[model samples]
Target: MNVLEIRNLTKKFGDFIAVDNMNLSVREGEIFGFLGANGAGKSTTINMISSLLRITKGEIELLGRNIVKESKFAKMNIGIVPQDLAIYEEMSAYENVSFFAGLYGLRGSLLKERTVEALDFVGLGDKHKALPKSFSGGMKRRLNIACAIAHRPKLIIMDEPTVGIDPQSRNYILNSVRMLNRMGCSIIYTSHYMEEVEEICTRIAIVDHGKIIAEGTKEQLKSIITDTKEIWIGVKKEDALDLEALKRISGIISVRLEEQTIKIVSKAEINNLNWIIQQLIKDQVEISSVEEQAPNLETVFLTLTGRNLRD
Candidate 1:
């Protein structure tokens, strides 16, 4: 079943369309990875889904109710963790989480219980009395998550929740996301870290220029590029390599020279590594090492958008 549904969802500012006619459905219990380059309309679309921004034209349904019309009913079932820290530095961890819980209509003893649970869920239970001002970067990021999950919303939207944090904290956040999904809360996870997304996400969607360019499992997305491979060759003399001649190879797609490294992309199914080596040998290029780069989520992103995921 789809926990969240968006149809023809669009948002426009004057003549510029921040989000085009977007359509998506997130199945229940999925850690949906939402990815895009900077200014790709990902934030705008998510803001509209959370009802923080009004949609120019479209429908957003949480569970089965229209979010814009039945906002109170829908918002109660949604939690948002913004990219920036959304906690009070002066307030203790418990009070900060309690405050957000109150916004979702949690109250009294139930609110306190849930607050404690959230704090512990993010591994900050002992630090409940500590002010956020004294916490490390990763702890602060985890606290931001604890604040969002205190109310136990059915759907949690996390925007770059692990950015600029230590690996330990990053692993904690990623594991917490898995725990939430296992406990039945759907998540919308956005990040520039391809490896994390590739490791944790059940499915992914790539957005660019206000539109979705690719959406599927990692294997399905990779199928879009067909069977492609990248080979990296290190030569004793970088100046002696003939890049133009290499580009003319039967299955060679492109050739690039990065310092002493000659990066060659080719159609994997048809290309011959031995033939490539023979060419280098034929050209009198001193080959020091030959390495084949594996195709991965990062490669898929670069193929679809013609730019790096971080770009």
Candidate 2:
């Protein structure tokens, strides 16, 4: 079952179209990775799903009810852990969780029980009476998560939940996300760290120019961008390597000499390694070793988006 569904969704600002006919879906029990560079309409789409922004056109259904028609139902079923911390420094950890959970209609003993449960779930049980201002960055982030989950929404949207935290805290949050999914919550996860998404996301969607350009498992996404392969050849002296000569080889797309290594991108189906080795040997370029590179999530993101870093 799909926990969230978006069809031909769009958002416009005056004449500028922020999101253009976007369609996406997140299945129940999935940690779905939503990726995009800055200004790619990812945030706009998310805002519409959460009912924070009015959709200019199209439909978004959360758990089978159209969000526009049933905004209360949609919001009740969704939990948002914003990239920006949403906790109050003045409030005790328990009070913070209780406050947000109460907004969703949790009250009395039930609210207190869930608030304590959430604190324990995020490893903050002992600090229930502590203020967020006195906490470490990671602890604060975890508290941010506790505030979101205290209500136990069916779907959770975690936007860069690990940003600016220590590695240990990052790992803790990642494990917590897995635990949440195991406990029957569908998740929509976003992160600039490609490795994090690769490690935890069940599937991923790449948004560009206000549209989804790619959607698949890690291997599937890699396959789409693997028509070309990179072979890194180590040489004794980089200056002696002729980049032009390597580029002239059939099926070779591009070549560059970096320090003591010569990088060559070629058609994947080509058998030009032997010829390239022979040419290097003939040119008296001492060869150390050669390695064929495999495509990873970072490779897919850069290849598809034509970018080195996200804004």
Candidate 3:
């Protein structure tokens, strides 16, 4: 079953088109990663789906209900964790959860139970009475998530929930997301951090300039690029290596020397490292370290957009 369906979705700001005739479907119980560079219309598209922004020309359906026509019903079933912190600093964690839960019509014992459950799920059960201002960056992020899931909505949309936080907090957020998905909640995740998307998303869609340039599983997306393997070899300062000889290797496409490091780009099937090591041994080139760069979502994004994610 398709939990969300967007057809010919277009949103414009005067002469600039934010989302142009976009169409995509997210399956039920699947973690869909919505990826793009900054200002790529990722937030705009998500805002529209969450009913926080109006569509200029198109149709959006949530769980088989049209967003424009049945907005109240659609909005009620979806949870949103915006990119920025949505909690009040003066309010305690318990109070924050209670407030958002109340918006969903939860009350009395039911509301209290759900609030505690959400706090515990994010590993902040002991800090229920603590105010947001007292929490660390990561803790505050967890509280943001707790408030969003207090209602247990069928679909959860998280936009860069782990940005600008310590590794411990990032891991906490990632684990909580996994736990939620295991409990059968569908998620639409948007982030410039390719590693996070690669870690949790079952399916990914890369959007650029208000359009989806590519969409697939991690392996499937990597397969789109022919050069899948990247080799980095650190050379000692004293090695009298012949650059021309290294370039003569059959599978080796290009070689560049940066300081004491040498980078080799090649096709995915080529075991260029083994051959390079053998040749280095034969030529008496001093090899300090040889590491192969694994194919990642970041590489795919760079190849597709011709720019870095943070750029």
Q: What is the TM-score of each predicted model, taking all chains together?
A: 0.87, 0.85, 0.83
Candidate 1 TM-score, true structure as reference: 0.87
- Worst lDDT run of 10 residues, candidate 2, spans 302-311
Pairwise TM-score winner, candidates 1 and 2: 1
Residue 157's lDDT within candidate 1 is 98
Could you tell me which residue pairs clash in candidate 2?
none
Off by over 4 Å in 3: 227-229, 233-292
Residue-pair clashes per prediction, in order, are 0, 0, 0
Record all residue pairs in model 3 with backbone atoms less than 3 Å apart, i.e. clashing. none
Per-residue alpha-carbon lDDT of model 3 for 117-223, expressed as tens digits?
99999989999999999999999999999999999999999999998999989998999899899998999998778888999999999899999999999999988
Model 2 CA deviation exceeding 4 Å by range? 231-290
Highest TM-score scorer? 1
lDDT of each model, Cα atoms only?
A: 0.90, 0.90, 0.88
Could you tell me the lDDT of residue 79 within candidate 1? 92
